[model samples]
Target: MGMLGNTFDIEQIEVHKGPQSSVFGSNAIAGLISLRSKPITDNFQSGFSISLGDDSHKAVKGFQNIKISNFLKVRYIIDYNYRDGFRNNILNGMIDSNRKKELFSRLKVEFHPIDQVRILGTYINANLDNRYDVWSPDNNEQFETYTDSLGEDSQKTQGFSLRSKMKINEDFNLLFISTRSNTQLVHAYDGDWANDSYWLDEHQFDPDSTGYNYSFYEKNKRSRHNDSQELRLSFKNLVTGFYFNNLSEKDDAIGYLFGGLGDQADGRYDFKAYAGYFQIHHNVAKKLKVMFNYRLEKNMYKYVGNTYDNYYGDDLPLVNYESENTMMGYKGSLLYALSDNSNSYFSYAKGFKAGGVNQEPNLNEFERIFDPEFLTNIEIGIKTIMNNFGYVINAFFGNRNNQQVTISKQRNVGDPNSFYFYTANSTSGYIRGLEMDLNYILGSNFTFQSTFGILDTYVENFEYELIENVKTRAGDRETAMAPKYTASFGLKFEKMDYYFLTSASYKSKYYYSDSHNKRSSAYTLTNITIGKKIKDFNLNFWVRNIFDVKYTIRGFYFGLIPEEDYPNQLFESYGNPRHFGITLDYGL
Candidate 1:
């Protein structure tokens, strides 16, 4: 969730969803995260590691590196981690434990000041603190299994970077990059049933005199600053080639807002953003490729305090808004090679997402304005590698426009004692997907890998008359953490010094509201690892989730009925249960 500085270190991570906004952008849509690290040869290395797990997890890591002769180099890394929370409240007996601490450090400097210059510098810092529990009630006896907690009340980040490369002969080349980043976050939560009715009728009384009281609060504070710059130019020979990429991004955000119910009363908001981009790529023969891109964005907003005319009886407390967005795109790809190993490709792309400012002070200022959401993607792919089997297949089609949903409505007008939710930019969608990956190398020891994915998402042309009597349909699916079959598999083994590993993951069945009504089921997880190497010291053992799957990953709902009268009461975000870990490594 945080990766700043070094603009792109992501080397290889293939998740599959297509068109990747011309080299990663548009939040990546939901896939594509490739990071690469570890370079600098002429070696002089160091390492240290320690880990212990199970409910009280702990970790420590270290690294120091050098390579100062061939070009220039330096590296340093330090890590520390701790974990405790596993949920347990039982009406304030505490122990929802939930604790997290993270500190990441990186310093890299490289210089090749002579033959065809090159330089790089990067620095990063990250901090995170978390607290848990947000829902519980699969029937904890009329709901009082204790609640109140939801994370990220604190988070911090800092980053800086510089990159340069140049080679002016032979074919020509130049590249430059600059970056700066800062971020802070506080997203609060506590929704103890907002307004309960003993979970509706879980046997009417006693044992605590029925349960469910009320409490829901919100406070979101965000401070972000970003500055980015990029430039690229390239030219090659042999037939022809050309490339140019330019990008500039600037963003500044400040926000503070609060929600009520209980202590009753607090509100404020602010937001801002600016963006820009440009791209070009060309190659007309050998497999062909062409690309073009454009982007411009702006947003500004401000709102202040109280407007409880009984939730909007007077409706006047939001009066500053501005938005501008422009996007243009073109893409082309064609790759063919049926002779050596195998290859095939096809693609199309277009994308945009911008439009904001809506904190719900009490609405009606046009629901605080919302628009801008567009997507167009088409893809086809095939790849094959012989000598030990390897495969990849992909398919995708998507179309979306003006869709920005998130409505939990139920204010009954500023404080029916309070329970509010708002978000708008309704309906226009279509999505289709399929992806597959497999690998096998059965001889050198044993190896196997697999991945599969499928998706069909919908909702189109919904005229939004406050949901148009609801049921804004078209195959309704795109929620429940957006799932429609996802899978992962892995196995590896090696002899000599001993090594073994296993992995599995899968997800299917979704619908967590958005009119599809609550539904979540389908889970599978497994992980195991074993390692041994006695010489320089290395030993490991691990087990994670291995069959203890309770499953829930995430869920939300505290008030506002609808979607089939709400109250399906299901809470069990348990996925990490059977965890046994041990690791040790030392080298110098």
Candidate 2:
């Protein structure tokens, strides 16, 4: 990802490191990112910012805050970004095969009707349009693609949320939040990545469609909607977790834009869920505290689909399948105050990932669903602060069952030349890691911080069928995307009205597929920023990937040509290169 520098409207960012499903449910398996929005001030405020960079990249953002009355206030934010890409399409010789464009806006309102009551409302809208060209041969440059067709990736999201806070009593308070959100994604690409002329001249094949160059064009769509409500009760030294429901339904389709052979495919995943959670925290002794939490949930899933092929006719019977599960999760912890500026804690947690319908139904027995997943985790940590310096150290271990793993062979349904991504359940796995964070300050003029992480993930038992004749031994193998080593270092400087910041991060190599046969090499990146602030106005210059290093974001094993001619090959989607940009912000 590229950096756009900091604007005037940002506050502190919070990062969580462990499994967050105990509080956030199933989606926080790895971790979670939380941004603390700036508070609405009592006075009127407005801000504007713009950024310009290499490769014709540009960004414009603005925010407005209005104090309508003593009891009401409103704020809104809008941002737009565009980039003319750096990669070239080797087949068509056109640049911007990897361009990006995005638009986002948010509105927030705060209302205070009574002395002890407060209400907040927020609405967010976002749209994204981008080009993706990643296919290439091994001998090509890093910034080139071999596809002869055009592709587009587009997405949009809309959200609305309401929150209420009330001081119920002196010793207890209540907080409630309700949200509704939806997201839609559309992906269209060339199925074969080769023009008809190439196929006709080299392989002596002709199709019915003659107006276009592509042999096959495919478009896919996915959409999701969610409605949730949460209520929290806070006491003097305790917090509460209440109830959850995930009545989820999926409507997805894949159809051809051209051609008749690879015509259409449709799929669906419908599910319902309900959960209840409870927690308690209390001081057991003078310097020690004990906490306990528990949760239980019920999940029901149904699968429905209609898949077709020209040769095989229909892949499935176009019927409905159902599965259901009930699971429990718990957490217990002990915390002790070692000193006035130091503390230590030990925690144990259990998490769950409910089962879901399958995307690919080509199995022998026609099993149409994967089982739910569960995890057991334990951790011990210490935190200390001494005037100008602070540090946190932690060690963790986790055991997992029915783990979900997605392996992409890049074969699209109905079309012989596209890609279909599917998820399946793995038997068992374990994860162990160590992490440390350090922060130091030098007389309010300089600040330094660093984080280091070491992780090891392995599957204990499972076997995955790669093809009709080949199956990968998935036992005792390292998991995908689990880099063994990762670290980041950052420094911040401030003097009189000027500020400067620099950061360096590193990640070790990791595998991209379930077979563990292919991997990405280790890489490091550096970024720097120098900015000046004049009261309500600010300006900055920044650069990312200063060393111009090459890295991979995604990789796949697939064949682009006819099955009889070319075998499956390794392909990669590369990371961004060196980028430099300047930003200006004004506040009034």
Candidate 3:
């Protein structure tokens, strides 16, 4: 789903790092982010919030809980947000090219048949109509685009989940959960960043040139459905569960390729998985403890694709592929207590991910499929609390085999406009990192927190075919999005119904793409919030990126225009500029 209800509805958030697949299934090789919403309460409560900011930013959210009876309760939440784009389009005189509009609603029902049993059902719907014309040919300009066509990205999603918990007896507990979700998404964009006149003037009607009056427009419709169920039983330091999941997705796209040629493509994918897992904790010594977890999963996947060229009236061959695999993951940890408030732990985990077919029709059979990836992580950490201070430090190393990597390349040599992307398996890779967190509380009114981390990642013995038959060895290189170092510090003070918070974060330069050596410069951001409470109302003011730093979030290296001899150059999408906002909340 595109949106996860409203942030105000969330009660808790948990962050787990390094190889969580043993508990969360696949795609958790690095970590997992878990969010839990507040439960329905018997007490009647209602609240609303309004926010306003620069760039025409506006948001409103409200929630209410109603106690219908002694045994049942209902809660509903709704949120609406709209913001004008920060970027301007000089070609069309449009300032809302990257606008954002969103609507979200959630309904939850709770049933308490008895003291030992509780059931909860929740339904959520989200609508997003956002613009995506953020790309530009000139990075020197400030938040401006020259494209003639404005892009669009929109989604409509609906989801429902049911969960029940029962205490069968003093020694056993049962829990069941089921969820269903579906999303309809439409995305369209102008692939070429330049205007028609610019391209025409560059190529001078040269049919042999790929950029000759180049016009590229692409639109895709995606529909996805997912269903999952899980049953769990817990008994004194031991937990076991069985899970089943199914997912189906369909994508239909139309592309206005070079010279306005029409290309149509359709693809469908299905995935199903079943798994059983168990976790156990035991005390091995007076001051030591041990924990173990295991999971076995079987998964199946299928892909079908068809392509056609409408302008040329040519149909491509159909593609149908199916695959199945069985995988196992496990985690083990040992904990030792040094004092009543201090503890140390060591952990090891194995994570697994399944591979599937590629939807692209332009690749050969060998390039259309990739192998699964595996990660084994080992970590040692110490956590301690001494009076008003607490700290945690950990160091971890991970080894991955058959690592899946994606790269984009031109279909033909020197034809930069024919770019296509695909995923492939690397022989091996490794990552090592150290992280530390520290917090201090003083006088019950002032608190300070800081975190620092350093990471190093390298891929070994990996090579790819840059063109039809030209193999290019990609020597040992650092992983994309892996910064060398990161640090953050925050301070908060509260007294007399008022509070103030300030934080600063820094990150070192990092590679932006694994396929190339394009890197982004190091940057830092600062944020501050001040709030005051008056009776049942709360008012707050916040400012983010106070320095107005222009940092890159994404970048690509390719040839686009003739102004620079069509030489490979860096194109980047930047993060948001400085933003300041005010919010008011009322509760009853």
Candidate 4:
């Protein structure tokens, strides 16, 4: 959802790095990106914002908040966005081949039953209509397209959450949270890049053997829902928490020619998980403090081929399993006051992640089983907040065992786009990294913030390459999708009722495939914004990718055409080009 970051309704975005299993869960292994919506105020508030940009991009946002009474309040938000693709169809001059449309709404209410109790309820609805049109092997330009059929990726989602806090005494409180969500997706694509006129001769030559239909199309789909609950109790020096979640998923990935044979691969998956945790903190001396946390977690999974509501089993019986696994997670930390403006912390944390079932059937006899993953982390960091400036620096060492890796299936001739993915585990790996974040308030109403991350990784004992069928030597390469370095810098200037901000971000080259030879090039992007506010009204202008650099974010190696049967070649998707926009805002 990075594209939605430009929306004016978002108040703040929080990034939590490293393994957070002691608090959040297994999904927060690498890191966590949290979006905090703009909070509702006590008095009445209303606002609207509009934006227009290049590529026919447009957006609208509006919100209202009211205090209904002394005991209750309500807030509502609505957002809409639309953008034309950067490239046009060479066939019909259609400019929106990669177009995207998004609509979202949210309702929130707060209740104060008494002096010691508080409750919040929220409901949300969202829809995304995205079109897919990317590159073909024959084309080298960023905006060129050669596919025959149009593709679509559409999703509809709805969810709700409830949170409550009860104050039991002067130094204790209880918290409860529950959430539910439902989602469905529709995705289809052109399996053959070229039109029938280009392949007519090859098809007619082998009609008796290949049949009459050769043109191809494919679709992969997902429908899933989940419910979860969490409870916590906090005291002066201790806290305890328990959480549970359940998820059910149904998937279909199928392909077919115009009139030829069709292949079907469908499955159902169910997951249930439970976790309990306890934490305690104490100050042993005037300038020293320590904390400890422990968590016990269990996860279960069941898979069948038939259906989500009707589980009768597939005829081929692709893969079936009912497995339960449990592990212990722990964390310990010590904090010392370095000076009146700075503090230092040392921490050690161990976390566990449950293994999951493979979505695709096994082509070879490797059992298609992945083991649970584990991580041990040790960190030493310092953080300080002074009147004019603040900075945080951290050095970390971590070991990840049984790291899960996803590999793309080897491509065949006729089904270039109908690819499936499966997962495996690395025996052990080592990762070391340094991170720094700095924010400074300048003398002339100017502010600056910058963050840098440098990482080094090695695969220790991995000896097998699944897709390429090769033996991997020690220290041969790093893990896939792990970048070596990333950095960002930003500057902000505000005086009176006006503000201007600009930022630049960079990421180093990284590997995507585990045959592990294919990699993406490093890239940098810049963005700037200017806005003014007057009597609850605001106007803004922004520009993104000011230099319009060409870069790729994802890549895969694949083969095409049954006639020549060539070796695999790299195919990639490019990032967006330069975009500039202006916005008018009220009470925002």
Candidate 5:
């Protein structure tokens, strides 16, 4: 709720089922996030907003725009926000406050050099600064004493993109898109080791006493850069149809050392990928339509780095390695209209997520190479509209092969001073699911919508020697944070003067890690908003997480720690608690 920003509104969206990978990429494996933006026209527009909320969080945001003519336009947005965290540093006896600040801007221009040709260009930039702490400790226990030295971390990201389109003729067209992104993170932690106190006392702390000894202090910094480009050409008619698309991407990263009185450790990694595909759609009869698509992709990786002295000494030379992967797939779909407002369709598709280099080489000199995982999906669905009511139902079954899994192990090579991290693909798995949605309007002022999805995921095989014992017990349900069921509902009331909205989301229980031993409970969250418009001004109040549920969203595993010694450091990514805020906005 709250202001939700221009990209976070849920009520203004409608859910749809289709093979989204064709357009949005592989991350849409579960589903797609559809966002609606304000319409663009040759007009002047501007708006501003301010809010105050729980945890001492305050926010101010505003945007201004202009139409320099029929061919040029510009828009700018700025937001200043601050918040105090809910967790307390037990050691330091102070609130673990989290803070964020962001600024974003966009510019667009259109040019028509000829009667039949046009060119459009756009530019956007955004910067984000986030600071937070890792609340939970190595043992599944919470720290009552929080320390400023124990909880400090920050992350930053910036990105930009450009796209262009050309009309070759009435039946053919061409398009090109390019994008670049950069991200960086720095983190440090120091605290008392309740469980690892004995090991720290002898190795990390003074051997004299256990009372108030500085236990662990270390820092990690990482930087990533990504660049991508794509081009597409299409031609369609009653007969002889053609479509082709191609894409290429490059990514690189560097890791830096931060603390621990230890020598800095560093690593570099890079990957490149190329893919191309062609598809055709045709109507063979008045009642039937058929489509076919085929695609192929190749990926390569390079890595270099030295393990930390605590894990591996400087005597060991940094390793250099390379890997390559390739995949080919095809898909087909059929559609038939039963009536003017009703239609049914069935589709079959296959795809793969490319494998990459494992730069964290800790102990063993062996290189890790994970094979590409493949997915085959079969789905049938129907969509119908009757009067003011509409409904969509879909059922899908997917099978995945040779799934990649990461496992952590400890290794102390020649030097007694350092430690190294080595990775390998250790497991295989499969996933299948169903999804449905409905919408209805009860007269002119009220509307309702609902959506539901279910996934059944499981492990198929475990073949690694290091984790054989743990893998045997890992069942089909222990795979990652994927929930078995997810659902949401929304209600909206709108009129000439005022508007009201309410919605709720639910996710089924699932584990945070591959071990399948640590599980997170199921939870439901609700939100509400009310707003009024007067003249050219608008005001609204919103409440989120109405029930104040305490739940974890994610967890991190420290491979250095022995499993028999303690649980994987169960650092909980806590869900946001109950919060309320009000916003005032003016349009010009």
Candidate 6:
């Protein structure tokens, strides 16, 4: 649900895997991504693109479409990008400490007064500014950083949407949708990534030890709002829907801003949802088909929290919470039609997730409410085409109940950056998976592709306690970044307007946290592309990580070095090293 503009103004992209929550509801239970954008016809079009790279990368993108006659149509899109951050902040010599910037704009409209009605509208504007001085005390210096407060990640977003389609005469059909969004966020960091003469050489024998003079800063300001509405109806084989949602959030947090001894917090959250859905398909003969789906949801939540702790000078009280829940989801399927190309299927699903409230800031009462998690899935699939080759395969099994696990807490236990994070509820879990896709065509200009996956995740018990009566158990771990074999392969070559491509990807070995047992060590990446098309003008060249492989996407296992007095290390973040780019395009 976080998608805005430009994939060349997408026309379609659909990916659904496991648990669609009986037709898109509640986080989709880890599956679902659907987007469709390009529409607006009747001639008139335009396009543009430009890019250049190498640390100081820059880019520009565009699109346009118009036709305002018999029934109105319009479209426009824009994108901008900038980059200059390869990280080399030797303490403020400022090489744009991890820089990046982006802007996106979009607008679309279509209306056909009558002809059985149709209307569509959309508008969006976005901005994302990023810079977060890559944490380091040394992960073998991937690029480099010796921060003294230099970090930020920003966001600004605006959105709107409306849709409608009607044609109720020849056997029912109607649809409507509405959406709204707003987001503003800023995240700040630099919690002693080292500077200040390395804490005065680790306090050289107590040289005014204000705990080795640490300096940490944190800023978190966020605001979010969302609204949604949907209605649907269609004849023949049934389809029905109704949904409404509203969400609100606010947070303003500040922390440890150096000696003023700070730590302030404020929070508010609200959510509401209601749903009704139905789907059915039947034709159990001549190639077989059967399907059924159902959904019912109701959820409401609210929270308020406040805190202040100027180095423990008190004032940590004032909190309120509320919750309600009722959820149900279902699906069943069976399909077969193994001729005209091929097909096969079998499925079962049930998923739900709702129950939250952990705006962290000193919490107890089971770390401030957390519950509600469920998933059950079973699947089997197959698809095939034989002439030039095509294939797909899937196999899955899953089970989880009350699982949601994320835990962290540390406040001045010698200040390992005084961490805080929460989410807990783990009682059972299981997962199994297999997936594959392949394609090949060689007669008219060569192409080949492949994909692979296999996974297993487990965590059977978790009896928690961070510290307080000390109790712990995490029976058989292995559920943190869950990675066990993944692969990709590609090759392409075209003959008409020149083209070439190469790709590679792989991953294995993972575990960044189930709260400790750091691991990550399997990586591969390769990419290359070249293109040319001289009709409407197009040119391209690209290279990415073609041999520069220094992996680690994220890792953090505590300990902030006061000469190892804070031991438990393992801090990393590295990905993206080799890159090359060039692009130019023009169209009409």
Backbone clashes under 3 angstroms, per model? 9, 1, 0, 0, 19, 0
- Indicate the TM-score of model 2: 0.89
Largest lDDT belongs to which candidate? 3
List runs of model 3 lying over 4 Å from the truth: 2-6, 198-212, 257-262, 412-417, 562-565
| Error of model 6, residue 170, in angstroms | 30
RMSD of 6: 24.1
lDDT values for all models: 0.60, 0.75, 0.86, 0.78, 0.60, 0.81
Better of 1 and 2 by TM-score: 2
Q: Estimate each model's TM-score.
A: 0.29, 0.89, 0.95, 0.90, 0.81, 0.33
Candidate 3 clash pair list = none
TM-score leader: 3
Give lDDT tens digits, candidate 6, residues 1-588. 243435767888889888787698878875787778778888889898998988888889888898988788898989898887778887678877888887888899889989999898898888888878877776765678888887888788898999998997887889999999899888888787767675676444243665446667788888999999999998888999899899888988887732233488778899999989999899989899999888988888988877777666776667788888888888898989989889899988988888778865556778688877878989898999889999999999889888788876554444655666688888878888899999999899988999999988887768767666677776477788889889999999998999999999999979877766678898989999898999999898998987888888878876676654667678888887888889998983
Residue 283 error, candidate 3, Å: 2.5
lDDT of 3 by residue, 419-486 (tens): 66788888899999999999999898999999999999988767787767788777388888889999
**For candidate 1, what's the RMSD?**
24.0
Model 4 per-residue lDDT tens digits across residues 169-283: 9999999999998888878877665555445653332545667544567777888898999999999999999999999988886655211223566778899999999999999
Q: Tens digits of per-residue lDDT for model 5 on 1-588?
A: 111244411125644344444434443333455765443446777777788887677877776666776655555556566666555554445554344444444455555456455555555455545445544443323323333454345545555655566778898877776777666656554432222443453345433554643334455676767777778777873222222223222222222222122345566777776667677889978989998877666666776766444544543356577787777666688998988999999998776666766654432334356676666778899989988899988888777666655543323211111222333444566677787889999899999999999888876545443431332334455467789999999999999989999999999988776543566779999999999988888888999988787766875444323223433344455767788988787873
The superposed Cα distance between candidate 4 and the true structure at residue 518, in angstroms, equals 1.6
Q: List runs of model 5 lying over 4 Å from the truth.
A: 1-40, 93-96, 138-145, 150-158, 187-207, 210-214, 237-263, 308-316, 363-367, 406-428, 465-475, 555-571
lDDT of 1 at 426: 61
Against the correct fold, how does model 4 do in TM-score?
0.90
The local distance difference test score of model 1 is 0.60
lDDT of residue 15 for candidate 5: 44
Query: Which portions of model 2 miss their true places by more than 4 Å?
Result: 1-10, 90-93, 194-214, 234-252, 256-262, 308-316, 365-367, 410-419, 442-445, 469-471, 561-565
